[model samples]
Target: MVKKGRPDKRSKTRSQAAGGGGGALPSGELIGPFDRTLLYLAVFLTGAAIMMIEVLGTRILGPFYGVGLFVWSSLISVTLIALALGYYLGGIAADRAKRFQLSHGIALAALATALIPVFKTPVLLQTNALGVRAGAFTSALLLFSVPLTLLAMVGPRVIKLCTSRLESVGRSAGSVYAFSTVGSVLGTLVLGFFLLPMMGTRTILYGVSVGLLVLAAVLALYERARRNTLGLLVLPFVSLAIAGLLFFLGGDRLPSTPGFTTVYEAQSIYGRVRVVDESERQIRWLLSDSSTIGAIDLRTGEPEFPYLYILEALPRFHPRGRSALLIGLGAGQLPKLLGRYGIETDSIEIDPEVARAAKDYFGFNHPGRLILGDARYEVRRLRKKYDFIIHDCFSRGVVPAHLLSVEMLQDLRSLLNDGGILALNFYGYAEGPQALPAAAVAKTIEAVFPFHRVFVSSLQTELTDHVFFASTEPVEFKADKVDIAPSPLGKLMLDNLFRYEHKISSDQGFVITDDFNPLDSMQVRKAEIYRHQVLSDISADLLAR
Candidate 1:
């Protein structure tokens, strides 16, 4: 068997053929230069398509499945596994089929690439219906994986087929891999930055579909100008029509219950941004990077700060309200709430797409100054000081490790006022009736600021991960007129959602540090409770019918 990096003899033959070392093509039986060139082009396109499919597949499934470190790790693992299998199979198949063999393999992958978008939704449905959460990811691999793996087979098969002069195959194989890699790099950058947002999901998918189908048709026609060639030509036309029909008349997805509606949905480089507005109320829920950041009730038009109460209490508890810094500006809730009380605010939210989104959909008015970059780096650069430095950076399912680093916390303290406060939100067993590693973060927070106080934002009903607030000053730990609380009339104005209690009071053993943040450990422990919370919080019953 040929090793992965080192070229086998067939590749050497192909290189010699390309270099004009082994004379010209010997008429009809020998492979023509155009044929070889076309074959290489086919290989390149298929390789590029394989990569883009992985990206697109993740985007398509991510809104439902999530795109956290867990999801990414799963997708990447499955892709490498598929590639390994492809490498193995391609070698075996090349050895067996010498005739229409290599040509057939690459052409088939092109055809399979065309088929991806059409089957995407149905596969999603099948996975959903299976209701197999344990293998939720493995199930994803089971479905779209076959086509993707098949697509990976194109390179080796093409290399094996095109070589007649054994000596040149080495350079030929390298050239093939190079073209394929270049195609992949180009595909990733273009699709991620330009295609997904500007063109729309349907356009991007169908565009790839059309390209792949055209390549397949080219191969079929190049093989023989028969009815099948004509038939292959018609496939893209039919695909276009079907894809168009799906795009234009795509029916709404009925929710499990009624009143919940997806007011807006878009793919962003960070993840999927979904703005779900409950019809019964003016509450707009923002899902950035797959986690719920804030829900603003449009009727009240005031940001409900469950955490605001906690943040406001800090100044009273700590008294130094000179400067304030915030990270993870979702809906600009924390910063917005701070601004309302006449406190100075500097906010950083990573995604510019998200920053714009916060304005258009999430009701997050642009802060006086909004910085777009990783919070860790931003904090290090800003030599300014704050009375209350808030580290509220939380993304769905996982938190950014940098934000929790001891180094970052220390830097944040450097800019902190002498009697300053640092409040960090951690979600523990919020669902109900479970053990959580929520204490780990508290321990970590304590490690950084040993003198700070921690409190739960909500009613403190269970062992849930809640807000662990740290302050240089000793907190009074009382909720007297918390800064963002509702008045009697304002409280009356809120939907029941605004009133649900948040869990904040618990001392888990470990804490998130520059070194040890066992989020997955916390997740596994709190899975059942978390699931119940999701079932209750985002229950199908609350969504659009």
Candidate 2:
């Protein structure tokens, strides 16, 4: 059971008389000085690490399964449980020792922290079910339980060590809490806003591992080098090697034919963006989830070309691409394609680094009106109505909370012209050759649009992402409506997409929510859980093949 606060002697005595406080802690003087410092550092580091583990965890899990709610919840819940266990166990460990030794405990705890970078991928890769159920989530909780639980002990255990008298106990606790919280504030600002996006995930993991290992070594300074010393040296190198291998070996690095010139490959703020040479048909901008949002074709590269699906689909449905808006600008592919087609696309993309990568590697330059901000805010501010709009922005690792909310969709609706078409893409779960999530999304779209039809993108299997296109008027795929010479590049892409044989399931459903439009909130039967399992099986199957 989770318990809190140090009770006064009088209260303890009264409770004992009432047969409820027989094991009450005896009042002691404030804890020692060295002990307090150790306690403070431990808690401070613990808080920072917790934030790192929680935030970075999402990024680590994202590539396999888009950062959906189920993944986020799994990460959150596991971290919480780790903290809870750490708190309870730390107190017991401290009380058993009578007087706390900062060095040994701190060293032990830091060593545990350092181990994270080492075992992270292996633990994940080796996890049974590859995570078909809550097993993955549960195991993750257990893996980190050792260090986090120990870290949790700092507050209460330190109070026990530092409190010299009953009167000063409360004051001492507050001081520690304040300092620790301050550490948390700095941790969030640095890691979330600055360090993570810039440094990238694997590098950051290595840095954290080094800091922790160093902390442990510093604690053991006075004594002769322990056997663990060699371990400290070797482990960091091992971590470096593993991270390096994973980085280089990552993604679909293999060739994707001749004309599709893939320009840049970097893990950036918006997952991974690849600018492709569609043999000058357009620069196809691809995001991590393999979604293309923007393209630029033609030698002039001015945002004004009249072309195929986008051209015909928009105007034919009582809407058109005069003031076209796109949420994701991968390699400026869609923008390039649209600009060549004369659409005058307005793009709102979150990651500037991705834009830079696009420029450097994928021919991503400013396409028409560029809005470098969150799409939701940009859409809210825009006064002109859009004939065509694409909701390509997703939760950084999953569907962003703001984007999924009814308010945001309503915002998008307001910006569209009468009978305008809006396309939304999401990665969700489906079963039995039927795209359930597509059906659910269709239901949500129907609620917003007056008339709509759901189109399922061909995934290799039942459990794959589905795209939905909804409009104020009905939509049908018309080949003749498309203008321009069908570029070899677009044709190649179309060919690959053609292999995907997914049809939208009419019977599948979802609870339409105005408040919490959470995808992947289901823990046990989570999207990620099923996906990882499938991925592992695929990996094994491919290896055997």
Candidate 3:
């Protein structure tokens, strides 16, 4: 029988062993309603924070390392490893250390999160020399491991704190994990759909860090109040001050280029888009991530890239062609030029920002229809046929593998008229390790259309852009039939257009399909080479900004 007005000895011992918490009943409810609420909130926030950082990590590392297979693999691998380690360590600490609390882990994670924007640039620059695979993995480990590990610890600790009786351990674990997983789902959706498109990378990161700090503060205050420890009342404020100071030291600033002025810069759903002008050179360029998608001569008001001229002259291959379809409207130069030729052109662009920048900064005024969507999906939706189709979506040192698959080529072929010609642009080495991507593309095109011709932008057999013209009928270029007025550079390109014609053997590459496409793996070395060149040409500070 229990004594009146006296605590049971077993209950007193259990409370003391739990380090200032009251004894739990058989139901395993060791915490009061207030304590349970704070614990669940902490778990929820940390779970959300982990996912937020994972998504934001891609944006932070993309400009330098690219948002490709290797980078994503590295980020995912690091996250899993850190979480595993955190779970193992947190379980041990929770069981052994009487003074350890969930608030401590949250506070530490807040500090680690604040350090990311501060040290990311230097860390990435250092790791970049390690090459793509190793560099991307190492950078992810250094920048994200500490915070993800700390945040991951919250889950196990919450589970331990909530489970007092061994009999109810299963129920407690399930409930705690349910809350955490739900938080992760919400975090991913909110970040991808809402936060990233609306705010810059740095701003979103700072906001996440601040949010974690606030959660940590609330948890710490609650813990202190529950323990009635007046001496530790200042701990939460001290952590906030230190985290705020770190954030202040790591503010984001745009880096200045020596000879160019940035006309506009913004983070889009696709990537970082920027318009930069070289006044002395009288040139302007539209950049997406680390790749220059389009450039124009400010003085002559003509597309500067030689590849654009090649595409413009493509219609010469089909003299009777009146209506055309253009894929990947970079600067809208090709369609604008086609409109000038009195040919009705319809264009498809995946990124809205690219289209906006084309109109606002690149003087892209297309008389034809501009459809905003992915070419792979948009091509299937078109009911009308065209005389000519141009595919130019290759960028960022890699092609969209889905666009180059056998199925996609078949779809593009289906959208063409009887005598229609399809032109595809690709960038890679003509012969060597990097030649596989280009060769595979050639093989895939041949799989759909029997008649095709390949043309290189430069005479050199090294890394360059190759344009392919494919059709059911024989693909031919009639120079005498071309009547459009050409810029001096365009004239130069036309003079040597046939000289750039080359061929890649079908045996050199396997056909790419939606089911089995190894293009990402095949082009790793090529991507690394291209990214290194971009890094050498542009300031690292500029890319970081």
Candidate 4:
């Protein structure tokens, strides 16, 4: 029988364990309040760092592989695999070891994260030869797998450390994961909204590595203080030194090009925007990721891309057009060109960085309104109508399929005047599996506008940029009627526009709608080919910048 004021032996043991007193487990020890707080903080920081690294993966791999479906797929798949393996291995280690230190996993993770910016160039260069799909996956795995895996282990070990009683195991695990998930949410928001735009990829990566190392050091100091051992505390300091050494050694300077100089470079939510100037050739290029979105002759200050010439000529079909709407303002060339014809142009640009680069470097000085937002949403908000609407948003070898759906075309059509012409620029092959996206675009455009004409930028039938002009009435390009006094190259392009005309059959592709748009999947081959061509033309070191 138990005394009225005293508890039984078993009940006393259970109470002590639940209360985190001595004899909580076989180790006969438990973390104090301060130590437990540090552990939870570590878990939260690791969670945030994991998400940050994952988001940065796209920006890191985008230069070589492009930000397409394959890159996203590879990144997501690799992250899941790393997390799974980490969870399994961490659970096994937690169950086997009598005592586990969270600092060990964190320190290793910090080192791994630090290695990314250091080894990214070599890893991407080697994997780039594997082609887009395999290269993106392999690059992501080689660079991010270890760090993500190590960071993932923090959750299990933290749950183990926080759970002092079997009865509290479920609650402890829930609490640990909840903190991690909240950290992830905050990390994603901060990275997308602020860090990527302000710091760029390499800087953000270095910061994340240092932050994780600091967390590890704090945990190490706490653990060492509790155990009365000073040796393990040196590990975090040593790791930090190595990380700092690597960061300084692995600088983020752009590699030198033989004849070109980098005039400007920045990171946007869309991708990396760079301006490269070739003095000898008198040409400057505006690049988004690996693809050259716009180019201008430094000597003449006129657009050099053949597609832009075709776009400029197509607007002449609607002779009475006094106002124009330009979507995807690359270097603001189209708007500037339209302004030359006394046409007031309103440009819708998605990335403010691109707009700034265009004005500062490319000498874009259009006196019209520059609306900065997604074309799909911004088009719906516009109350005014336009005589011509131009769509040229292709960049980084991937099309924004959402913007090309039948629904989006209808919106553009709604904004057009009766004789208004809608010109779209697309990049793909003319006749092959890669041609499906272009064919789908043509069909979707035709579904909205009855008459249209397609023109290719290059004479070759291979992968190239194609311009489609659609209107309610017959589309006509009277080159003889318009006398804009184009350059020799532009004149040549204008003269041969009909020679480059292509008519894609409806059967080749179905109408792409918002509910069922397969344009991304269909353009995979084309994107790979286009990216490869761009990569071949430019040095890998230049793109790595």
Q: Best candidate per TM-score, number?
A: 4
Better of 1 and 2 by TM-score: 1
**Between prediction 1 and prediction 3, which has the larger lDDT?**
3
**lDDT (tens digit, per residue) of candidate 3 on 399-422:** 688898999989989889988999
**Candidate 1 Cα lDDT to native:** 0.60
Candidate models: Cα lDDT each: 0.60, 0.54, 0.80, 0.83
Tens digits of per-residue lDDT, candidate 2, 1-545, equal: 33567567776654333321111123432224664675577567656765675676655554444455555677778777866776676667655653333344544555565555456555655554444335447545645666666556655655554555556668867876776677667776778778866765656655664555454445334211322333334433443455445445442342244455555555565554444455535544344532233445445443221122332234333323566887866555565555544677778778776667656654656456767887767777889888788776643234554575556667788888876778676655555423444466666666677665433343454444454567776765554655644345444434454354345545665634656554544322434445544343233221111
Off by over 4 Å in 1: 1-33, 88-135, 168-171, 225-257, 280-282, 302-305, 430-436, 459-465, 477-518, 525-532, 539-545
Query: 1-545 in candidate 1: lDDT tens per residue?
Result: 87888978986655544433211122113466887888788778877777777787666555555555445666777778888888778766655543333334444554454455455555555554433243346645864577567767767766754665566578768877888888888888888878876754545656675576566656656654422234444544454455446545543342333656776666566766667776676677776533566677777756544655555444445443645787887777666555644577788888776677678875666345688988877877787777777777765355565566566777777887776778777665554334345555556666678565555545554533365567665655433544555433333423232244343344446555656665664464343344344435553333211
Judge candidate 2 at residue 323 and give its lDDT: 64
Residue pairs of candidate 3 with colliding backbone atoms? none
TM-score of 4: 0.92
lDDT of 4 by residue, 29-77 (tens): 6556875787778778888988899989999988778888898999999
TM-score of each: 0.78, 0.68, 0.91, 0.92
| Candidates 1 and 3, the one with greater TM-score | 3
TM-score-best of 2 and 4: 4
In terms of lDDT, the poorest run of 10 residues in model 4 is 19-28
